[model samples]
Target: MKIRKQLPISALIAASALISTQAMAEVFVAPFGGYSFGASDFSITDEKTDELGSLKISESNHYGFMAGVTTKDPGDIYFLYSHQGTELRSGGSFSPNVITDLNVDYFHLGGSLYFPNGNLKPYVTASLGLTQMRPGDNYSTESRFSMGFGAGIEYQMTEAFSLFADARGYATFVNSSSALFCDGGDCLWSISSDIMWQGQANLGVKLKF
Candidate 1:
């Protein structure tokens, strides 16, 4: 992929230097668990030709995990990791009682630049990582991968700890399809991977070292 002039090489280098220096201060690792709610949808495009179809799915009420490192001061840079997942049940006859499980697993290796002087430390964090979604049943499953980014705020209690929350979204790219069911003669039904989008709201605590 070619990076445009808007994302200059100099800016990239500068950000790298910043993170390197920030890492030296003090690093604290915290394991956080939270609940997530979202939704999912699906659609089918070409009935013939490629037997191609699309799925639009949005679901919520799931669980998530986050692990990160924080600095000693209220306003400093820190790195973090996060994850979320859930399951959906299809309704009636066609419903197939099919369970649609969407799991978002993210390995984020990024830093947060916080504003400590304010009543609440408002920070902007950007992460470049891999996101995977798994839609499956008791016997079969399918998965996809994509990149993710996040930004939010953190409120400090003491210099060593605080409460924080953030809203993060992920865009995924995966090729999906339904299995072909045949009754000894003809093809019954088929489904295909269209495209999917996922968004999440995270609430947790930041304990500084």
Candidate 2:
């Protein structure tokens, strides 16, 4: 998949807040769907993929929702939940003849700051929470602490409706000292525990309360 990383922190936060009233706005909800891009290959097990081999995960689409409070100062404090997955491919001459699957579920406490314009809003977001990775079949699952950030723009359609688009990245941290899988006296690193990161492009509709 062809994907470009977009990392931008608004340089005009102070300059753009001249129109704020500092009053609290009502609650809001944003439901979104988008395409997910997987990070570069990494070993699930302790063994370095360069020495052993690599597992390639196919980029797939994901969907999620956010519930938050939008303030007149142009900020959002929201809870976000997203579902993501990919197909697993191992790099080797003799590949395993098994169908493997990979999935991730994210639960985050996220926040955003927007350069609020009359009808066009540009924003940046950050979040930290839990990431759960499930490898298909009987493989043990991996769950770890994760963090992510994003930037986007929103265009208001009416007093209570808006459309927005954003690009974001989430990373899961799971490290091991030694391989978790052992075979006859030889141990392979854990397949369920590894550092993983994912990027996404999303478009969603927001409803104001």
Candidate 3:
């Protein structure tokens, strides 16, 4: 019996003259727009609070821009940064009118192993960032630390142009100790701390300059 040893994609890419050699790399920028849907959990304490039932938020539409870098040498490493904003609409025990709308802005930065074959190139990426969540008029917005891990495919149209679609889950820990109500004032009691998760599927174009 023979045993096969496998190396990580990063190491493999570096070994293949993949994209980690060139010093003067060209920047790749793309204006992307996409939609996202996810759940948000609310925590209440023993103090004064509004009576609201378990809630669900409508699927949201988001838009943003992305910019990255591609090396001149095939074996060089690549990096990308993206910032997206979305509006959240919710209904249930809160103010159906005012509380229904909120804003969430997410930031992501990661590295990839490029396979510049033809029109399509498959790659894997890992990123860590943050999300600033604003739950509307009365609710206080909080910034949370997030992390993402995913893979996607990139298709090239010309030497300096391409199209890409990717699906990745982003999450972070929320510290609600100084929490306040979304409807009005400070919370009677604040939430301890917990983790929240969100996922996104996006399709956009990329240009290498």
lDDT for each residue of candidate 2 in 1-209, tens digit (9 for 90 to 100): 12322223233454355434333566899999999886656555334442454556578888999998886557888999998776766654326333477787899998999997789999999999998867775555657899999999999999889999999998878664544324444554544435677888999999988
Clashes of each: 19, 4, 8
Error of 2 at 23 (Å): 6.6
Task: Compute each candidate's TM-score over C-alphas.
Answer: 0.59, 0.76, 0.70
Weakest 10 consecutive residues, lDDT, candidate 3?
A: 73-82
Candidate 1 lDDT over 1-209, as tens digits, reads 36676478879899998997676565454555554444445443333444433333445444444445555443344344555555644432234343455555665556667776565877766665565554444323334455555667777677677777777666655455544222344333344544455676777776656
* RMSD list, candidates in order: 10.3, 13.1, 8.9
Over the stretch 164-201, how does candidate 3's per-residue lDDT look in tens digits?
Answer: 88776777676756563444655433554476666677
* Each model's lDDT: 0.54, 0.76, 0.62
Give candidate 1's total backbone clashes: 19
Candidate numbers sorted by lDDT from highest down: 2, 3, 1
The residue-level lDDT of candidate 3 at 123 comes to 72
| Per-residue lDDT of 103 in model 3 | 68
Model 3 lDDT on a 0 to 1 scale: 0.62
Q: Give the TM-score of candidate 1.
A: 0.59
Best prediction by lDDT? 2
